[model samples]
Target: MDSGEKRLNELGYKQELRREMTLFKTFAISFSTMTLFTGIIPLYGSSLLYAGPASLVWGWVVVSFFTWFVGLAMAEICSSFPTTGSLYFWAAHLASPKWGPFASWCCAWLETIGLIAGMGTQAYAGSQTLQSIILLCTGTNKDGGYFAPKWLFLCMYIGLTIIWAVLNTFALEVIAFIDIISMWWQVAGGLVIIIMLPLVALTTQSASYVFTHFEMSPKATGISSKPYAVILSFLVSQYSLYGYDSAAHLTEETKGADKAGPIAILSSINLGSFFQHSETSYDFSYLYDTSNETAGAFVPAQILYDAFHGRYHNSTGAIILLFVIWGSFFFGGLSVTTSAARVVYALSRDKGIPFSSIWRQLHPKHKVPSNAVWLCAAICIILGLPILKVNVVFTAITSICTIGWVGGYAVPIFARMVMAEQKFNAGPFYLGKASRPICLIAFLWICYTCSVFLLPTFYPISWDNFNYAPVALGVGLGLIMLWWLLDARKWFTGPVRNIDNENGKV
Candidate 1:
């Protein structure tokens, strides 16, 4: 079966995504607000409005520190063996043949699920933004998707997915350029609010709310009594540091991937995390209410709008600004769309995805993965249904979104563990004198984050089905493992055999 993989290497030349993406452009377009990943939509930046700004803010700081350690370790691994398939490639090389296939399979599972969960979470939030903008237009207090008809919200969520699918499927450069445009809007939008909102009546929120330490209600209820309230705050810290590795996953397509790729990933994490620090700091918290209404499971632009327009209910100017904020939110979503295709192409090349045949096909003229791009776009549209039920099981099982991803970080560490015990010289970024100790510490932290992330928001666990977020994550992984043992083992041996270094192909 790998014979075909070999054949793909010598196949005709084709063009799709340009190979010219510079390190700066890649980082700039892909990096997003901390709120975008943690606060708005799915996680609701729980710290900002729920865990109290102080706790949430500090938690993020701790998270960022932890993030640096993890990124540094990954940077070491990535510099040594960069590949578009990301962890799977690393895992395969690090492990022996007997375990290598299993390791690589798990890595692919993690990458796929992480992408699906992350995208679904974001799309759900995007849909809510769409509804919120409409409510703003109608001047109604009805609020977002939770209040809107399920089908309608679903339509919006899926609709945005289609928009992304189509946009991402075709133009990788267009995605990067538009993302660049949106990054400015995101920065400027924040600046606009901080600067402009003050001009009109000092933009009222509550200083006390900003500093308060509160507990989450549902989670406080016996034996499963772990303090998840900590997570509500700390997760902002966790998420702020997440997703920086996405660029490294695309390293094979990047120029000077060996040196620049890992650097880009780390830089994106640092830049994004710093912005979050700025958002959560007391200087900014003073402008926010510690107990500001849970912006629900989906609604960043709405949060932004209410922050700016709520005080000016009667002022047409503030209302107009609210509209502008919504426009920018969509602009932000558009940028996310741009990168979706590349993930497809890269994943396909690794043979980690279904429809591997077509997805591996590059565009005849564009130098991009045409079929892979469309496939991801189509899935985005279909999976968009989850956003409509923002708090439902469909949307709720993502506790493993981070758990699943831990392998990406964990694999290299574990492999380093395996290798160090046996002694093997690795790359420039390889763990040096402190290799074993550093890998051990990073692995422990990854486990800690995974445990809490998997634990349900509710604590004092009653037998009321005991929220299956973690269980679901495990089941998903289990299924992948089962599949690997029974099916993926023999012929699907990752994309390594398909490498076309001689032809400069991934």
Candidate 2:
């Protein structure tokens, strides 16, 4: 057996996932999961409505820096204990023995829930982008003929989710290659739009308009003050920066995971931030000149339509850009499904979840977590059903994902920095003396962002417009606590070692 396989055995788990992914492929999976077009394009209009250009541009920079620190901290932990369980494994290993079980249980559920919401949000965006592309091609406005209905969009979302689930059931090498292709597609496709949009436009916004311009729409007027508007606008960038932990979750399937895992996590964030800054800045500039009352509702789509109106035949250029983005979103959902199912499989293997035997099953031929993949897909579809009735469901899902993901990230970093600092054995990718302070900063940043996510997205919040992130998160946590009290605490430990003498190794 190889060293990586030996390490897995020493940790009391057999090597189950196919370890065929090289460093580049590992990084590609995480980068694809953090797809720039999928996150930024869908939410561009909302940011414009709140904080305008200044916040949209600068908030991205600020969030990227803090997000890098968070990724760095997680990368450090991942180097020491590379496992599919990721944050939950880090929490259990880094915390005191007495508190380990509770921490792992909470972290596992938070990460799983966050991943489900993240997957749903990506598919949801792709569905909307597809609908928008159809509208643009048909030359149909809201008042025009043949506009698609919300039910159709919901069907699209569900169909997309199922497609991702099916795609992920393939062999590991196939998915890895798909992710590598997705990485280049995002890089090349993003550069094309960022450069072409400005060059094609007849009139471009000046640097002042792009950097200093600020406006608050009437929809945001009564509900949000200027300062709060800026804070809320950060969501556009913050949401884009998450899901980088897909790297850590795939560690079991990655070669040289102790080193490659950390590199994948940090590199994904850095590369994603680079492309996001370029694409979003240009996108914001384009919005500055073209944003009318109607355009404000779908900023990116309208910007494309306006910029290439007369340049290309039949608005083909705009449709192409939309299709590129739609394809990126589809690939992103596939990567997320892969990551989420691994988390489900890991948790189930530890018997931390109900029906553990079922979810823990690996496909005999493909060597993938087939059942877990479908379960995650089903949950994503159900979570997204609200979009058929309320458009604000997107915002709620975004907030839920942000809060749940950051919460999962924070617990392990907290344990590493404050709970078990001396216990941590730094791997080859160790941060040395800087680990504690960096983790502390990352934890604090997570706390601040989690608070931001809980705030109301709009004012005069009624049942119809209320952000259900808190409610959904609350119910999830309540169930976890109830499960702990009733049953889990009796038999569930942090992790169950399958190999003999495993307890002695720790």
Where does model 1 exceed 4 Å of error?
1-17, 33-50, 142-147, 193-226, 277-311, 315-344, 386-390, 393-400, 421-431, 459-468, 499-506
Error of 1 at 493 (Å): 2.5
Sequence-dependent TM-score of model 1:
0.79
Instruction: Output the number of the TM-score-best candidate.
Output: 2
TM-score, prediction 2? 0.94
Across 1-506, the per-residue lDDT of candidate 2 in tens digits comes to 65555666766776778887888999999999997784445363266667677777788889999998899899888888888888998899898998999899889888998898889888878887788787776763633524468898889999999999999898988888999999999999988987888787767777787688787764543444888889877888888898889988888888888888999999998887886432323344335332331233356677677667745535678889989988899889989999999999999999888899999999999999999999999999999888877767887887887788778999999999876456777776788789889998999999999888888877677777677888888987898889899998899897888666535443
Give, for candidate 2, the lowest lDDT window spanning 10 residues. Answer: 288-297
Model 1, range 1-506, lDDT digits (tens) per residue?
12212222333222233556667656655564222334322243334443445566567667777777777777777676655556666777677777777777766667666565555555666665565555545554533313356788888767766676666555566666766666566666656655555345334445465355453333322222225456655764564456666666556555665666677778876765654432312222322332333233333433444444555554355445544555454554454444445555666766767777788887676666667656655665665554444444332534544565554577766776667445443544565777667777777788788766655443445544255666666677788778777887876775446445475765
Q: Give the worst 10-residue stretch by lDDT in candidate 1.
A: 1-10
- Candidate 1 clash figure, as a count: 15
Off-target runs (Cα >4 Å) in candidate 2 are 38-45, 142-145, 218-224, 276-297, 310-313, 501-506
